[model samples]
Target: MISHTAAITIYTKTGERREMAEATPYEEQRRRQVEANKRKLEELQLHHLSAAIREAAAAAKPSLVKKRKARVPLDVADAVMEPVRRSGRLANLPDKPVYREKVPDFGMKIRRTYGSVRRDLTNRVYATDDARSYAISKAEDLEQELDSSFPIFIKPMTQSHVTGGFWLGLPIHFCRKYLPKRDEMITLVDEDDDESDTLYLAMKRGLSAGWRGFAVQQKLVDGDCLVFQLIEQTKFKVYITRASSYYESED
Candidate 1:
């Protein structure tokens, strides 16, 4: 049996009291439960890894068998039956079926824009330092010449390796002139602005005039600089040029 004791000790002229307690059964049980949970989680991870290995082995068996069957035998004749053997291997290879789809060829399209700017106009701003001023000037010029609220995508020109050279500011007007019947909504791909910035400020600075600003790290080609206004979401594609290439058919 354990015995309980109470004592008062004084280290100096002032009196001080101290107490020490033994662990209770409830505390011990809680500690054991926490340890058990940790072990259970480790076991679950091991089980998941084992399952993944088994699934991979099951998927690879058929592919291995097909490759083995396609392997050429060493006993075959070299000169007498060379064309037949080559044709046989070609026949066994997988066929790539072509499907027709109408894809746009926006040669040098300006898709989006990204950057940051200060909130006030009274604040002295320089063209080199102020992103908002640059965007506004570009937008105003495009609007006056094009006569439409064409979608202008905005992005940063800092630290970003622009593969395509800067936009010549003609594609936006051209798209507006040609694709006039489509919806024109400006989308700002603001790489510099965080979620806290107001939509009004972004629009006033000639950035995409809307609340729906998305961030995308586009893979751009070298010597390419995009500048244009999109007519609709369907007309725009994220990383379209880098994703695929087209082959022309002989007429």
Candidate 2:
């Protein structure tokens, strides 16, 4: 025993339908307020996130510091980069020294005594040693060879000649000469053969006295030799190969 109810239908003439319910003014305003509140919250979150990122970057960044330079000593300033001398080497300098020499004085007197003939006697010397060793040694081979070595018993006379087995002469040719002007020593140099028998004289020292002094000392005016034989007055022959003791000189 239930009864059925039917809804009321309103039909337009052209057959259009109307809404069943409509929105209220309060609902529209509430929806708009909700949307605005959502937008303000999103903006606030973004601003907070940006502020946090800036703070983190500032804390992580490095700070800058100032630097200082090292100092050098003033005493050794000039010694730097200067060239130094090597080992065992010397350097250039000044104030050196110098040197010199000396001289001496001469002492002695030489002169001619006898037995110098016509010959060149410049700057030469002689002695009994000057007599050639071979010539006197080869006496057997020499012409006019005496039976033995003989000395001449000289006689002061008007003429000079050879006597019987005796030879005589004024023998003033055996001495040397000294030139005072040139200060040169003139020595005896023998340049003759047996036919001439020219004598030359030379010596480191000179006659202490003249030939007359020598003749008196050696008794040459009388006779002195290796062999002796008096044939007559001022006429004698003797072997005369002997050292010259009659002549003395200074060293």
Candidate 3:
């Protein structure tokens, strides 16, 4: 009885497995279809053909080397922050030259010519205060004694006119009005009636040449005043007022 029951249990489990298999016909059919396709691929030798194509493509292609990975931005950040380096050749160049201007020397020449009309070693003379005052008074007296019809011009003498540079510059207005426009010989008649010939330079507006002799003979000095009365076109009647101490001494 135990053997029969054990047999019965085995038979029952076999029957349930058979029934489950029969119920899933679609799964069994799909599995059989996949097996049949694999058999067909094997019969056509398609698996071997695919493997040959892969090998042929690999053999035709060039070999590739593995590329190194790119560096991160932070890895080269210090190098980017550093300043640019200068060329080594620039350090050997010479420095640029500086230029300076030379100063002039004029002290010696100025000392020799200062206050000199003729630029000679002779001492320069100026009129005394008393002599200038006396000459002006004497000039007014001489102007009144001259003829009223004739035009008169007065001049006060200086060292350049009477001594060192005997060059006399006449009044510009007088030369423009009464004197000739061209240079000519003019006569100077002193109070003694002695006549002297002098060149009147229209350009210079002064007496030249014969004037030195007239100035010497008149004994004219600095601060002396002279009155010139134009009597004719080229003739002048001259009167002198001396600045001598003799006149003051006499008074």
Model 1 C-alpha RMSD vs. true structure (Å) is 31.1
User: Model 1: per-residue lDDT, tens digit, 146-243?
Assistant: 52565544333322223221121223444444443332333333223222111212112222222211222343322222333454543432111111
Q: Which ranges in model 3 have alpha carbons more than 4 Å from their true place?
A: 1-126, 245-251
Q: How many angstroms is residue 33 displaced in model 1 relative to the true structure, after the best TM-score fit?
A: 99
lDDT of each: 0.37, 0.33, 0.74
Displacement of residue 247 (Cα, Å) in model 1 is 42
Per-model TM against the reference: 0.18, 0.14, 0.49
Say which candidate scores most in lDDT. 3
Model 2, range 80-197, lDDT digits (tens) per residue? 6444556444444322433421111223332323322222325222334323232233322322354333332222211111111122323343122211221222221111211111
Candidate 3 at residue 243, lDDT? 75
User: TM-score of predicted model 1?
Assistant: 0.18
lDDT of 1 at 201: 20
Q: Please report the TM-score between candidate 3 and the true structure.
A: 0.49
Scored by TM-score, the top model is 3
